[model samples]
Target: MKDESLIFGTRAIIEAITANKSIDKLFIQKGLQGELSRELMSLVKKNNITFTYVPVEKLNRLTRNNHQGVVAYISPIDFYDLENLVMNVIESGKTPLFLILDQLSDVRNFGAIIRTAECTGVDGIIIQKKGGAPVNADTIKTSAGAVFKIPICKVDHIKDAMFYLQGSGIQVVAATEKAESTIYDTNLTIPSAIIMGSEGKGISPSVLKLVDQSAKLPMYGDIASLNVSVACGVILYEAIRQRL
Candidate 1:
């Protein structure tokens, strides 16, 4: 999609990546053949950047400029390396607290989670590189600038991050309606990472199997579930409460 955060043209994208710019997504026109396009593909592959090849009509919809078969959305904030962030948090002697999102798609929900995480003293927030919302203008607006204040890491896979966090002695807790224990009963006084799922499907089953524990929020009303962001806020505040 074309926006203030987007940069089109094969050469421009290559240069942006070379400059260490955080590209949220890249779109290439299908059957786009050119020397520069080849170079762009090579660079994208080498860097493990996510890209999609779309039809020319899709390219046209992305931007009216000379796209040269490539367009990318530049992230508003730089992403943190998960390993380094976790290491630093441990070394700092503060009880590690992290929030993880499993394929949460809505930009507004993503923003609200970030705001809540920031307010709750979460050390960082993690989301997958693909199948999740980007740190775009809408997200920034919804976050009210909290997106810039928090450390966010984009991981290749949610399960991998869970494994790493568990290895690092941080417990991975999942929030799901299926859980028997409510958040108040869950242990959050230790180093922990709480995962909130997508708006539609909740956490993927594969990812859920990797978590050390799963808990749900108490619901007195007839509604079966709360919104993802609202659930995240409740879970985060509970963690903060236990720590206090």
Candidate 2:
């Protein structure tokens, strides 16, 4: 992790928010109270920043410097606007391929999926801003620098992105074992975004209802589930194979 990835102190964080820095997440002292803290809270609300209240010990673990009861992890990459990216891809005459992560919690899985997305020529990746993994140091490390090569959009909700993709003629395909059809049976050559759920829970029921299609990988053994990253790579390559 780079040293600059973290920035503490209430004033510095406020300034970063005002400057529109992409903060992955923020940790604030549980019972922090001060005029500067009040100002910082105002800025956080104004910018709709994602943050959580934590113990002072957690803040200390994040940084040893004088944090003034706040610590922020800066995102290493700039996120793309989902609608704009979709429009750009459509206008460019290329069949847009995307990946939508549904509250995926593992940073390494997110990173590996990103690397695969870049390698397979995915147009962009979409994730909800509030949940799932942030593109922090662990994400960047596992992505093997591919995070810089791809455009990742952070939307407010997964369903919103799914609706937008469907409206724009892109199919949302959910990767889960519940599907009657396997990835080989699905048509991946078309404009589509494959949605992978979290490691434990499959796709959320509300979200599963909205996808254009649901797909599953073949289950030959007693083990029914594959790691999310490995499953993502498998499905993506299946798409590639179909396209080829």
Instruction: Please report the candidate that would top lDDT against the real structure.
Output: 2
Off by over 4 Å in 1: none
Location of the lowest summed lDDT over 10 successive residues in candidate 2: 1-10
TM-score of 2: 0.96
lDDT of each: 0.91, 0.92
Native-to-model Cα distance after best TM-score fit, residue 77 in candidate 1, in Å: 0.8
Q: Model 2, range 39-134, lDDT digits (tens) per residue?
A: 999988887888999999999888888999999988889999999999999999988899999999999999999999999999999998887888
Q: How close is candidate 1 to the true structure, as a TM-score?
A: 0.98
> What's the count of clashing pairs in each model shown?
0, 0
Q: Which stretches of candidate 2 lie over 4 Å from their true place?
A: none
lDDT of 1 by residue, 1-244 (tens): 3377889988889999999899899998889887888888898998899998888888788778788888888998999999999999999999999999999999999998888888888999999999899899989988889999999999999989999999999999999998999889999999999999899999999988888999999899998999999989988888888888
